[model samples]
Target: MLGARGGWQALRGCASLPRAQPAVRLRVREALGAREPAGEVKVQGWVRSVRSQKEVLFLHINDGSSLENLQVVADPSLENRDLTFGSAVEVQGKLVKSPHKMQNMELKAETIRVVGPCDTWSFPLKMKERHPLEYVRQFPHLRCRNNMLGSLLRIRSEATAAIHSFFQDNGYVHIHTPIITSNDCEGAGELFQIEVSWVEKLPETHFFNVPAFLTVSGQLHLEVMAGAFTHVFTFGPTFRAENSQSRRHLAEFYMVEAELSFTESLQDVMQVMEDLFKTATNTVLSKCPRDVELFHKYIAPAQKDRLEQVLKNKFVTISYNEAVEILKQASQTFTFKPEWGCDLQTEHEKYLVKHCGEVPVFVINYPYDLKPFYMRDNEDGPQHTVAAVDLLVPGIGELCGGSLREERLPFLKSRLQRLGLADAYEWYLDLRKFGSVPHGGFGMGFERYLQYILGVDNIKDVIPFPRFPHSCIL
Candidate 1:
């Protein structure tokens, strides 16, 4: 936002107006909500559009407070080169009832001052031009001025607040997990190891005295906290060095993770995931109706009805065997064939969601070997599986993944020993030594969740600064 004027420039615009009622400074959103007719007032915002007529000049200005712009009707004499689109300006005027049906109030400008001037010829965005997401994405520094991104960020903020409220209201203690850690929660080996600028390798001489890397998930640390606090949650940035540029993959992203102690069933974890999604979605819709409507109206036309169905109905659940069977019988051929032990591919996940009426589907009881060592073993038979679950939504395939953690000492010890991680995770083994309880947790990709709800095809657009393969734009 443009800074306020100092000394004399502060009172210049409003002071020039014939003072009957004292001028009140109101934001664009506040001015737009006038009932009858407010007296002298002042508003400041960036110029969105300027329409000059023979009698009057119509200017639409916005201050990023809302999606809608406040209409400012000024005399044609007030129009100048500096009042072009994308420039910052302040207007002193009388806020009166608008005769136009589109809005409730309009500003009858007494004076207009251009606070900050913009070079219109060099501006990436143009007046009355609805730039596509891909095009606007190129200008990362200035793309927020675009309507699509502005609406997305607003909705993202609301959803973030709603998530925090959901956990806090449900008796969960929030935790700040570490950004750099020695433990890999998922055991995927995809990590961004930290390094000093000039040093090559620092083992004993290292700052931390051991290898450290950016976190892949906060689940492990949350589990440590859950031992003390029955319920705990973490909402923060997590990183992975994945080299893919798929719409669903990002090198840097956020995860919403929660852990619950004294809960043995995957059903408990699944219930939390479903509840969190529905609660956050409802809040985002209520708080940012028009912003959400922008994506539904223009980006994805069918999303409105699709979202309603998801919110109103209960999520469907199927065992991993059942999911594999459904996929095997499907008439559609997949790039990766659906097998019992193989992890579900994005293609397979999309088909499963569509097969289940486009609602979120929870696939539980995956093969024991397919999941990480932390997941509790199902302890059944030749075709063995574990108590692991993944939530699949409509467009994006897997929105969340969770499992009931291995609580028994012998079971977890054996699993870690087989994977050669027993020595590395001695501290984790100590957690079981100190009276462990049956517990489970799940992690949902925050950006993926936003992508799912907003109908945004590209994951890059939902985040402010996307870090991906060979590209980290400011």
Candidate 2:
């Protein structure tokens, strides 16, 4: 059963797709990049514009491959009622050099076919009109047709690839953590408990036989993997059950988490975090310059030079004590007054970034009581703190959060026992019972990272499907 007789033979029927001959199908990107004339080629895309003149007709089409649309020139006789904005079409054309100064190539079509026509009267988007982001947000299913969201999605895709490459290049094993877990990593209890819809008749029964909830963070799971593989990471969707009315919180979001083994100091963790951010930013800028330019040119003009300066220099670092002192001494009054032991609020974080010269800053050494139990405890006189750090950027308050995890069995056991999570996390304690080393890791909010790089105001705009308090549209 395990050999090729049953294993490979059973899947042989569905192993590979059917091989076929090639056709003259060309993507808009390829068509636009043609140097000389491409004869008898076919291009298919949705119509972005259809203009009719007395002598000729002009058509602009895009196939989601790039931001730039390919120009199609044809005789006025090819124009039809179905050839409107947002309609899908196929053109048998010859690609040639364009006379226009803006673009390089244009498509000279012999025949045009309307594969899918758009009902322009009922369509929400208009031809050549730049709709506001909020107006297009109402139509989530169709908003990708808009230029801004398309650019955003393209940049997001590149950033994701760059992050994965950064970890792989550094010899880190990528792990797929579970979506449903019993342990709440943050211990804040903001969890979405799972239940069977059909089991509503039996109110007392449990679905998984225990209280299972969507995982908040993969940090706890990555800690387990770190013991085996020295460096490990996971990037996936994480869920939270909050009536999130703010722009920052989403019911479902993504987190990029990494764990390291035998790391003695908190700086080791901070260095990796910094490197990941800079590498991803550089890759995205290099790969998708025009898509990135769309936002920098229109959305946030001042962000361009600030980002250049940020990439040129090192990020600033300060302790929680210093940050609190800085906030207290600032001329601007905070809504929540700055205190030594309390957690830093958004206003406090923004002020601290401003105080640090508008560059990204790492605020470390948080109060032990204010942090989770898993952080390594630093024993000091009357004022104990943990080795935790938060990377704050110019626009976004907190982009990344990390800490040196408690590797000692006795320290972790005592802390978990005090918090009444010892019984539930016995598997986690067992990792320390064996061969445990001083380990640390960090988690970066994917949307927050995108928001920081692009200077996006709302967190909802960066992500494709904005899942928040009263919205879950297709």
Candidate 3:
């Protein structure tokens, strides 16, 4: 250890040294957006294609920043055998106007260096061949190299940013909810329990003294925060062990949940949900026009007009009873016919959307027995109902679900007791005892939302790595 004087001198010596600066680099999107040619610029990316001629070698390089690849023109002498499709390389070149009509600029390479060599025979992706989405799903580890999936990822990133901005601008406090908890928000009895192995005899007590599981939703935690903050939101991963193999179900996915305090009725919650959907969609459409167009042109051509209609039309609202009545009168036959007390199936939801002129529609006032214990009782005389709502869109059935929470302590305790869950939710009951205001919230499945927006039929394609029943590929 150094003395005081020695330490001070050492500190002064350290402070006199120059700090290191990060190396300057430009993304492909940024480079392409330049107004004038850049001199002596350096670019590094994976080669998408390479063509060799007697005089010159042309390479198409992509950095996953945009759908379009950077055109690189190199002298034949600088070409190496490793500079093939999917090989990572760095080039020192000058940017110049391209003679080709496809792109505006090209890189005139002075020197080329191979950073990493990819085996063309083993690579799943091929040059100049369009691979179907299902075909690319087999290679989750390398699917981001494809132009379509890469564009989807970029759009997803932009949408996430837009959501955060929307919440922050609207005075909502962002909260991080716990990933492990003892209580299930949905009470669906489909939780993934956490278990730990023991070296010796099995321990009598669990890790948390009680059972724990991956959270199904962040609504309860957001509600806790809402008790303090007027408006709170959480965006994170949520898990469900439904063992569903449908196109819209996932074992693990992302959810965006928001809780609003001092809400008077269910309409307030519905309005916020509608606003969030529109705002985020508009932001994505404006910021990622090319990527959105790519999906529309190739994947789902019919979705473009539907999306425009969704943005333009006011979402239709109807009571659950009205929806059931309409379904009952429809000429279409159903496997599970629409009933008054049963939960709405995907077929019923799709029919409702189509009936509403192919626009988003909100069905409210669901039967009390159909919803969870936390929903507020509407007390509508003979047939009881809950102040709950579900937002249904054209392609996807139910996009969002929310309700006004039960603020009455006695009613909440009674409902919990009836469900045989009062002991597990003592703390939740205490929230009402201390001080509870009229509050409501909704949860939107991020993957499903992306699926509806991009018009991707399979939920697996929207997520980077999909987790489902009997499938958990990289």
Return the top candidate by lDDT. Answer: 1
State, as a TM-score between 0 and 1, how close model 2 is to the true structure: 0.94
Q: Point out the higher-scoring one by TM-score: 1 or 3.
A: 3
lDDT of each: 0.93, 0.91, 0.91
lDDT of 3 by residue, 1-474 (tens): 999999978877896777554334667776777668877788889999999999999999889888888889999999888988999998877888888887888889988899999999989999988899999999999999988899999999999999999999999999999999988999898899988877764667788889899999999988888899999999999999997889999999999999999997899999999999999999999999999998898999989888998898799999999999999999999889888899999999999999989898999999999899999999898789999999998778998999999999989999999999898899999899887999999999888899998899999899899899888876
Predicted structure 3: lDDT: 0.91
List TM-scores for all candidates, in order.
0.93, 0.94, 0.94
What's the true lDDT of residue 335 in model 3?
89
List clashing residue pairs in candidate 2. none
Which of 1 and 2 is the better model by lDDT? Answer: 1
How many clashes show up per model?
Answer: 0, 0, 0
Model 2 spans with C-alpha error above 4 angstroms: 1-23, 199-201
Worst 10 residues of 2 by lDDT: 14-23
Cα lDDT over the full model 1: 0.93
Candidates 2 and 3 compared: the better one by lDDT is 2
Worst 10 residues of 3 by lDDT: 19-28
Error of 1 at 425 (Å): 1.0
State the local distance difference test value for candidate 2: 0.91
